[model samples]
Target: MLPRPSRLTLPSIARWARLNGSSSRAASGGVTLLPTQEPTPEANATLTEEEFSSMIIHGRSIYPPLYHPRTHSVPVAQLQFRAYQHQFLDLYMHFVGHAAAALGIPISRPVYLPTQRSLWTVPRGPFVHKKSQENFERKVHKRAIKAWDADPEVVDRWVRYITRHAMPGVGLRVTQWKRAPLGIGQQMVDSAVGQTRLGSGAVKVKALAEKIVQQELLVEENADTATR
Candidate 1:
């Protein structure tokens, strides 16, 4: 008779079974946190101590240390998108790609830098797993209350999101503007108008900012020639 499957062996078998069972369900590819193949000597070349230390501390991709230096050679401008909008970030990334395509900009080697943003992110909910509907609702209410009060967790998430997406785009957009100001300004203006804002007088400021962005009119060096 075959031996019974012990608990130790059961988990492995169960996991394998689940993976094989779901293999045909859909083709959602997985991300390998660890590299499958060893890095080549070129890729693994010794970075300076500062580079190695900083990269490890910040949880950055070690493979591409060339991005920052490259930015200097290619003009990079800084931009800030002040708010708590992850959805906007996703949409803006897509918009940037589409705009890049239209303007014949090369995006094959684009790098995203998020270390220089100034917003914070709060947790969406609790730490429970496979929670019931009631529990989920309670968690959401708690989070919502905390976020309303400007909870530290909420602030952290917002800061992280902006840091990662906005910084890189600042440079990218500035370069694009220099190449095609009229087109880029119009795009920015449309984006600013569609964006959500809060508080008294916020709407007016948003509109004004949109106009300035759309017209590329920051300094009034040629005020007489421009329409306000």
Candidate 2:
């Protein structure tokens, strides 16, 4: 079956109501009877003809427009201000990342935010085994290269460049990530950082490596029991 017509937008509904000399509410419920149009037999199936006619008349009584009136206009100046704020925050985060990389410090270490009176630390979890760790790192490398396939670098070069530049830059700037555009900034940084809990891909692989050793120990114990 064909889809029913979508509800008209507020502007269209208002225009139709005005042209018909009826309130918007009325325009919604009032169906105009064309010259050859007859009430459907189904209308009388539920009630007597007179009763059906009355029901038709009642259904035609359009309700008032459910117009949501905004109290104040959004100032264009405020919007422009917000845009500028976003740009500044983005640049600042970039600068932070570059600085952190130069210092050779892990960005995830709890750094005291003097102004905020709190320390900021990145998230840390999602441990796996050593064999799993190698697979995980390989997967990350493949995915990252594929994602940036449009860029002007081969996979090895891209990985090297990211290790020397992008990763550290991202780690450094994360402290300021929250100040950037909430939606866009968070997504970009998260993509760069992998999971927020673990600082970077390297950390995630290390955690997975530890789990793999534990699994090996369990397998050795099971083998000894079977031999005995």
Candidate 3:
């Protein structure tokens, strides 16, 4: 079967309602229908037929627009979901897409991975009845969602939201990439030096190094004096 048609936006729906003159005063207050002239019988019939056909073909429902990743070079978080049921996986992915949009995170289209199938066979009765066997198979469905140009905190929240409301039988895995400045290591070391825990250890190491250097210098001076 062909995939369901894309959903119509709110404005489109309101415009259609206005054109059909089915809009109520409370619902369409201040919103005006086009042409202001009465639509002819033939035109109205054709429009109604077309709208009915569209509703039937499109399943008579609407959804939010799909989000596109904002940046390709920036770091991103990849969320992978796995489930045994394909329908549930698709529904969960749609929910995730909506959530991502709500969080203002740019996301790419869900990439459907190849289905994995495994089969097992076991004897129905005893080993003597090996010829009579039962066969069982399992299929795993997978989908990948990539979100880009998202703040780290926002990504964390998104993950937490999904985790909190996760559906049963769905498995989620998240991989995040963090991009840091070139001198981050030095910055981390410098920052660690002033910390309560790392600072004491660093100070102790520095003192030990200085003491070793001083002892080596005295040993060299004594050798030089003996030579003199």
Q: What is the model-wide C-alpha lDDT for candidate 3? A: 0.72
TM-scores of all candidate predictions against the true structure: 0.19, 0.15, 0.59
Poorest 10 consecutive residues by lDDT, candidate 2: 137-146
Q: Which number leads on TM-score?
A: 3
- In the range 154-186, model 1's lDDT, one tens digit per residue, is 334433453466533222222112334568888
Task: Give one clash count per candidate, in the order shown.
Answer: 16, 8, 0
RMSD of each: 24.6, 29.2, 9.0
- 98-213, model 2: which lDDT tens digit per residue? 33333222222122222212234433434443233221111111000011111222223323443464322222211011123459977887777765555646777897999999
Best by lDDT: 3
What local distance difference test score does each model get?
0.36, 0.33, 0.72
TM-score of 1: 0.19
Model 2 misplaced stretches (Cα beyond 4 Å): 1-195, 201-205, 208-210, 221-228
lDDT of 3 by residue, 1-228 (tens): 235342333234434554555454345784444444443444443343223332421222346434744865465799999999988888778778867776778888889899999999988998789799999999999999888898889999989998898988899999998778799999888787767566668778888999999999999999999999
